[model samples]
Target: MKNIQRLEMETKGIALSQQELIIYLQENGLQPHEEYNAQSPSAKKAIYQTALSTLESVANNPEMMRNVKMDDMTVSEFHENLTDRIDQLEKKIRGMRTDANQSDFFMLFN
Candidate 1:
């Protein structure tokens, strides 16, 4: 649906068709809320989750991360970049969770 495309745009370099998104959600045991907008923190979390998963797929594979030069980039550098992106996404997701789950705590002193 429109929401999926919006999510794709929000996610840098990510492009997943509706079917692909559904499959990913199913495969990863992820289910976005019934009414999630592209700008919602939850939606951003889901997008980051998807992007993280995509990167981890290649990052986890030594062969995929093997000697593959892109102009001036080295294989080690590429792997490091992917690792950094995955780490960043993880941190973002954690922050989103913290924000979304915030609650008030009160204490009284007599």
Candidate 2:
């Protein structure tokens, strides 16, 4: 048996997103099941299962294991990425609100 640490919804103050899982699966060379949409329930399940299998390999699994030489994401880098994503989301929300307000204003004229 292999010791596989299951990833939680939020790990170390960072919320895990579906995109991250898909990336991990791809990095590990697992071909995600394509029958369903990328965000579909069946696709997610298939990706998760493949990842779990890769993590289970006891021997030196270069594909699944993190390579220090290639992987360079530090805490600071993660924080910066998170901040950028939040900023983008905030901008999008603001745009949506402005659009909604404009729509309402136009409705009043008609």
My TM-score estimates for the predictions, one after another, are 0.61, 0.29
The lDDT values for all models are: 0.61, 0.39
Off by over 4 Å in 2: 1-70, 97-110
What is the C-alpha local distance difference test score of candidate 2? 0.39
Encode model 2's per-residue lDDT on 33-52: one tens digit a residue: 33333434433443344444
Residue-pair clashes per candidate = 0, 0
Clashes of 2: 0
Residue 79 C-alpha lDDT in model 1: 80
Q: Report the poorest 10 consecutive residues by lDDT, candidate 2.
A: 1-10
What digit string (tens of lDDT, one per residue) describes model 1 on residues 1-110? 44445445544443345676655554544553344455566655666677667677667677756645578889888888878888888888766742355555434775
Candidate number with greatest TM-score? 1
TM-score of 1: 0.61
Instruction: Return the top candidate by lDDT.
Output: 1
